[model samples]
Every structure is written in structure tokens, then in C-alpha cells.
Target: MAGEEFEYEYLYKALAKYANEHQYPLAQQAYEGAGAAEKIHAAILKEAANVKTYEGTTVYVCPICGYVMAGDSIPERCPVCGGPERQYEKF
Candidate 1:
């Protein structure tokens, strides 16, 4: 999982860099979203390593955006994309 995260991080960073250099704002935003998603995934892995358990926890992923949140309940809106709670998919 860590290796996958790093791969995605590297890929998104490269995409973002290339898109920005070529003045593709939309592509850059999409790459940024992908990068943000990987970052959240990495953070969750780090947290899991520290806690050593996923019991009594919930992970929510936004469908419209790559936003992710771990908690007891889904957030009212995605922090990254402002999607509603109903748009989130639980994992």
C-alpha cells in the first residue's frame, strides 16, 4: 500500500508539473486532486500504523472528488470538493 501510494504521489506530481508548465489549468487541478487523494491515503496508513487498529472507525470517500475522511460519521461536505455527505462512499 505504501509503495502504491508513493507511485501515485510521484505520478501526480509529475502530471501536475507538466500540466502547469504547459498552462493546462484543468489538468493541473485534476493532478492536484489525485495528489491530494494519495496524501490522504498515506495519512490514513500512517494513522493506522500508529493506532494499530481500525475498529470503531469509519472511512468515507467522496465520489465527486477524491476527498477522504476517517471518523465515526461522514462529513457534511467534502473539504476538498464541497460534495454533500450523501455523495460519500464508505470503506
Candidate 2:
């Protein structure tokens, strides 16, 4: 799963770079947003390797950049994208 996440992160970053070179602002932002999620996913997987079991937890995902948080409530803004807490989705 970590390998897959890293692969996706690389793909998104490459797409973002290409979009930027082509002057496609929206496409670039979209790819970058996806990349943020993939980046977080890889990190989470790496750290989760120490865990032996999973339990109930509320997970939040930032809509703008796909940032993630595991808690009872979300932060005022996404640390990665600065998206508002209201914009985050429960997962």
C-alpha cells in the first residue's frame, strides 16, 4: 500500500509539473491537491507499521488538498492546504 501511494504521489507531481509548464492552472492545482493526499497516505502507512490493531476513529479529509486527520474534530484549517474545517469531509 505504501508503494502504491508513493507511485501515485510521483504520478500526480509529474502531472502537476506538466500542467504548470503548459500553463493549465486548474489542472496543476488538481494534480497538486491529489499529490498532497498521496503524500500523506504514504507517511501514514509508514508510521502505521508499528500498530498491531485498528479501532474506532473519526477520520477527516480536506477537500482542497486531501489532507487527513484522525480525531474527534478537525482543525481550524488543513495544515497542508489551509482549507477551512467546514470544507473537510468525514471518512
Candidate 3:
């Protein structure tokens, strides 16, 4: 999971750089979405390792975008896509 997180981070940075250099707004937005998801994944891994547990938890992922939230409930709106909470699917 940590390795995956680093991969995502690398992808996010590379995409962001390319987007900026090419003035691709869509790609820039995708970088933001990817970054958000990667941060959440990294945090989840760190927390699980610290507590030595991974039970009775939920991870919500926005279908419209890659926004990820770990908790019992989803956010009111996806920070990246502005998708409604109901749009999030459990992962």
C-alpha cells in the first residue's frame, strides 16, 4: 500500500508538471483529484499501521472523481468533483 501511495504521488506530480507546461486545465484538475486520493490512501495506511488494526472501517470513493474519504460517512460534497455524498461508492 505504501508503494502504491508513492506511485500515486509520483503520478500526481508528473501529471501536474505536464499539465502546467502544456496549459492543460483538465489534466491539472485530474492531478488534483489524484493527489487527494493518494493523500487519503497514505493516511489510511499510516493510521492502520500505527493502530495495528483495519476492522470496522469504511472507505468511500467518489465515482465521478477520484476523491477518497475514510470514515463512517461520506463528505457532503466531493472536494475535487463537487459530486454529492450519495455519489460516493464504498471501497
Listed per candidate, the RMSD to the true structure in angstroms reads: 2.4, 2.9, 2.4
Model 1 regions lying over 4 Å from their true place: 4-9
Model 2 misplacement above 4 A: 54-58, 63-65, 71-74, 80-82, 87-91
lDDT of 1: 0.81
RMSD of 2: 2.9
- lDDT (Cα) of model 2: 0.78
> Can you write out model 3's per-residue Cα lDDT over 29-70, one digit (the tens) per residue?
888777777777777777777886657778788888766688
Estimate the TM-score of every prediction: 0.75, 0.69, 0.74
Q: For this target, which candidate reaches the highest TM-score against the unseen true structure? A: 1
Single out the weakest 10-residue window by summed lDDT for candidate 3: 2-11
- Report clash pairs, candidate 2: none
| Clash pairs detected, candidate 1 | none
Predicted structure 3: lDDT = 0.78
